[model samples]
Target: MKVLLVTQYFSPENFKSNDIAFELAKRGYDIDVLTGIPNYPEGKYYKGFGLFRKRVEKINGVRVYRSFQFSRGQNKQWRLALNYLSFAFFASIWALFLSLFKHYDCVIVHAPSPIIQALPGILVKKIQRIPLYLWVLDLWPEAMQSGGGIQNKRILTTIENIVKFIYTNSTNILISSEEFRIPILKKGNYNEKIEYFPNWSEDLLFMRQDFDIPALPKGFIIMLAGNLGKSQDLDAVLKAAMEMKNSNNIKWVLIGDGSKKSWIDDAIVKKDLQDNVFTLGRFPFEYMPTFFKSADALLITLSGEYPDLKLVVPARLQSYMAAGRPVLAMIDGAGADLIHKANCGYSVKSGDYISLARIIRDKVFSDLETFEKLGLNGRKYFEKHFQKNKCINHLCKIIDSK
Candidate 1:
């Protein structure tokens, strides 16, 4: 089967779409990607890519069609909006032109952000009368509101309308978390079309690795890897570190980069947490498994201020589980429930630094055997639910259906 995968980010930039496309290709599917220039977490364009450059290239046997889009410069709201809209406009035009000559069995839109990315997929589906599958990784206006991106009621309503249109036009919707279903259903009359499709860890890069990285600290490491952003409520983490200053055996390691890194850096110095907390800037995706293996526990957090955040199951959760480490989550709703259900570790309400510190000091640091058992449970849960092959096979079934 030939499938057109649409996303704003692709290979060499680190996104789930890369793994999904490759896995499908290995399964004997002809996959073509429609994406923008590779500029993600870092707002600038990647080296060798520019405003007008190679529009098409084959990466690892998958044909990728690149479109013109602005960079998300340093969290500037206007730049980010332009980046999102430009990709929608250019990708739709590019896909429309391509549709006149080539044919695809279906178009799968991987929506991690800027739900507007679905615009081109909708256009292709309308023009070619092929199935349009939307895989929603993040909820709209809610995420924006939580991030303090959009405050004006008019803008929020407009975005809501766009979201409704995208959901209404899609042939099927795949939600990453079970909690996303009801919220999406509230946006459009596609309840029957929506299916729960949780994301799997990037098994190729996120498995147990034997290599030793010298930078990893010796003490009980509580590591938080992935985008370090305001939404993560890292302020609470810093507060927890402050409260646990006496607990010298435990150390906190934060990996990855985002808009909030500067704030975290300042907090580390101001709060005098240099010894208890360590910040290892972003590393390549291949190095993640080694970092995970080196850590005793993985931390996942989301801001309590955003109620919608409760519905989110951060992508790193699966990676942590796949690495066979106990999870320590300061998140609520679906994310917390998943950890509890898996019996993988402990979870506290978002921003509850007191409880977070207590858990680490009492349960995690004191009981090594229980911590190991929790890690084992997480690995078992990952195998049963979040394995890449199983999830991809389920995705194939969905694509082949109807």
Candidate 2:
């Protein structure tokens, strides 16, 4: 079978979209990925990527097509708007041209945010009339309000209308979280078209890499890996760390960089959390497993108390489990439930720093063997449910049946 994968971000940007494309190609399916320039997580363009440079390449049997897009600069709201709008416009034109030459069985879109990324696939579905499967990783206007803090109802309503249109057009809607179903239904009046399809750990995280890193301190390492953005709720985690500052042997290691890095740096100095909290900065995606292996437990947190916001799932949850470590979640809804259901580790309500601090000081400090057991449970759960091969097979089944 042949597939046309549409996404705003792709390889070199370090998203699961890369895995979906390359792995499918390796499994004997023809795949072509249409994406914008590699600029994500960080607002600027990656080192070697430019408008005309590396526009088309075939990587590991998968053909990739790049479209012109404005690089997100400094992450101002306006810059983000340009980044989304530019790709939606340019990639659609690229798709139209590509369709005249090549043919595919269907189009599958890996949509993270700005669901507008799927417009190219929608265009193809309209023209050639092929199946358009939308893998919805992030809920729209609601997420904008919760994560981006855009309170203007007018702006949200406009985005809401777009979300409905995208949902209405897709041949099938695949949601990353079960909690997202109701919102999709309300937005597009979706019926039998929507299905639950959660994310898995990046395939590389399960591989054993011989990379070495500087030694962590002589203490228990509780780590958080991924974007240090506002939605991560790191500020509350910092406050929780303050309560446990006296525990010299327990260190909070944060691994990743984002919009909140500078703010976190300032807070570390101001709050005198230098001893307990350590930011190791950003590293390559290949090194994630090594860093995760160094941690005694992996921490994942989300910022909001809103019901819909709590339902949002972060992709790192599977990566942490793939590292074969105990999970610590400072979140509610789907994420917190996953932790409890898997019996992987402890969880506290979102925004409850006091409870979070207590859980850290009490549970982590009590019995080390318990964590080992919990870690084993998590790894077992990951292999059963969220392992790459297993999830990829599940993904193919969904696409084939559709």
Candidate 3:
């Protein structure tokens, strides 16, 4: 079958869409990816990728059609909005043009942020009379309000309408979190249209990748990897580190880069957490296990303001599980439920740095045996539920079903 997979981010951008396209290709399906030039959390074009450059190519057996998108410079709110709209506008142009010659059986949209990327798939579906599967990793206006700190009801309502339109046009709605189902149904024409589909861990995560270790502290490291963004509540995470700054044994490390990098840098100096905290910027996804190897515990955080955010499970959690590391979460709802279900590690309520610091001191610090046990439990849970092939096979089954 010929599939047009659409996303604002793809392979070189370090998104799971790359995996989906490649896996489908491996299954003998012809996959074409419609995506923007690779600029993401860093908000700059990746090396060798730029506007009107590398617009057509093959990557991992999938033909890629890159759009001329505005790079999200430093991801300021206005710039982010432009970045999202540019992809929708340019990619829809591609959709309309490609429809004349590319006879795709269906369209699949991988939505991380700016689910607006699905605009092209909707256009393609309408033009080709084919189904559009919207795999939503983040819920829309809710995420914006909670993560972006957008409180203007007018703005949120507009975004909500856009989300509804996207969801309404999607033939199948696949969610990364079960908690997302109810909220999405209220806006979309969803009646058995939504399916609870979770993200899978990368195969490389299960196998250790050999690499030189970065300058991580030689102590009990509590590491947080992935986007350093507002939604991650890194400020509060740093506050927790401050609460335990005198502990001397536990260290806090942040991996990955985003708009929040400067904020985190300022906070580190202001909070006097220089010795207790370290920030190692972005690296390839394959190097995760190597970074994780030095981590005594993996940390994941979510801000508490938006109830919608509670529905999120932070995709990095699956990689942490696959690495067999004990997780330290400052979150609530489905994400916390998953941690509890797997018996992975202890969690404090979102925004509760006091309890989080207490847990780090009382539970997660220097207890090698307990860490090993919790890590083992998490690894076993990942093997059972999130193996790459198993999750993708289920997705294919869903796609092939009536």
Candidate 4:
């Protein structure tokens, strides 16, 4: 089968679509990707990638077509808007051209955010009458509102209308979390179409060999990987570290980068947490498994209270589980529920620094046997649910379904 994968972010930008496209191609599917210039967490084009750089390239035998889109600079809302809309516009034009010449059986839209990413898939579906599957990784207006991105009611309503249109048009809507179903249903008539298709850990994480990296710091490392943004509520982690400064030999290692890195750096300096807190910035996606293996526990944090993070499941959780490490979740809703259900870690209420500190000091630091057991449980849970082959097979079934 020939599949067209549409997304704003792709490989070299640390997105799951990179693995998805490669895996689909490996499974004997002709995969073509439609994406923008590789610029993501850094908010600028990657080296050798710019507005006029190579628009077409091949990676691992899969054909990739790039489009022109504005870069999302640091906290620039206008540029961010252009980054989203411009990709949608150019991607749609590219998809329309592809549909006219390329014979594709299906089009899969990877909607990580800015639901506008699905615009190209919708256009291709309209022109070729092929199946269009939308894999929603994040909810739109709610994520924007929660992250303090879009505040104007009028603009929010307009985005909601666009979301409704895209959801209504797609042949299948694959939600990363079960909780996402109701909100999407409220937006469009997709009751029969909506399927629970959660994200999976990359195959490399499972296959990676343990290697000793000298740069790894000593102490009981409690690592947090991925975007250190405001939505992650990492300030709570810093506060917990402050409280547990002299309690144990635990070290708080933060990996990845985002808009909040500057704030975190300033906080570490002001609070004199140089010894307890360590920032590694962003590392290559391939290095993630090694980092997880070197850590004692993996930390996952989300902002807000119990119901605040109900509809989404952070992709990092799956990666942590695949690495066979105990998870420490300072979150609630679906994320906490997953950890609890897997029996793979402990959870404290969001923003509860005292509880977070206590857990790190008492449960995590003191109990090695229990932590190992939790890590085992997490790996088992990952194999049963978030394994890449299983998820991809399920996706294939959905694509081939009539």
Candidate models: Cα lDDT each: 0.89, 0.85, 0.87, 0.86
What is the TM-score of each predicted model, taking all chains together?
A: 0.97, 0.97, 0.96, 0.96
RMSD list, candidates in order: 1.5, 1.5, 1.6, 1.7
- Model 4, 1-402: lDDT tens digits are 999999999987777798789988999999999999988988888999887777899999999999888888787778888899999998889988998999889999999878899998899988988899999988887877877556799998998888889888888889899989888877766899888999898654556656544486778899999998888998898999988898768889999898799999999999999999999888777788888878889999998742436667899999888888889988878888899999999998788889988877788768788887898898889989999899988988898785
Off by over 4 Å in 4: 203-206, 209-214, 305-308
Clashing residue pairs in candidate 4 are: none
Ranking by lDDT: 1, 3, 4, 2
* Count of backbone clashes, every candidate in sequence: 0, 0, 0, 0
**Lowest summed-lDDT stretch of 10 residues in model 4?**
204-213
Extract clashing residue pairs from model 3. none
Clashing pairs in 1: none
- For residues 63-113, write the lDDT of model 1, one tens digit per residue: 999998888889688888888899999999988987887899999999988
Q: Which lDDT tens digits does candidate 2 get at residues 163-281? A: 88888889889888998998788765687898888898865454766677767766888899889988888888898888778864778999899889999999999999898889988
| Candidate 1: worst-modelled 10 consecutive residues by lDDT | 204-213
As a whole number from 0 to 100, the lDDT of residue 168 in candidate 1 is 91
Best by lDDT: 1
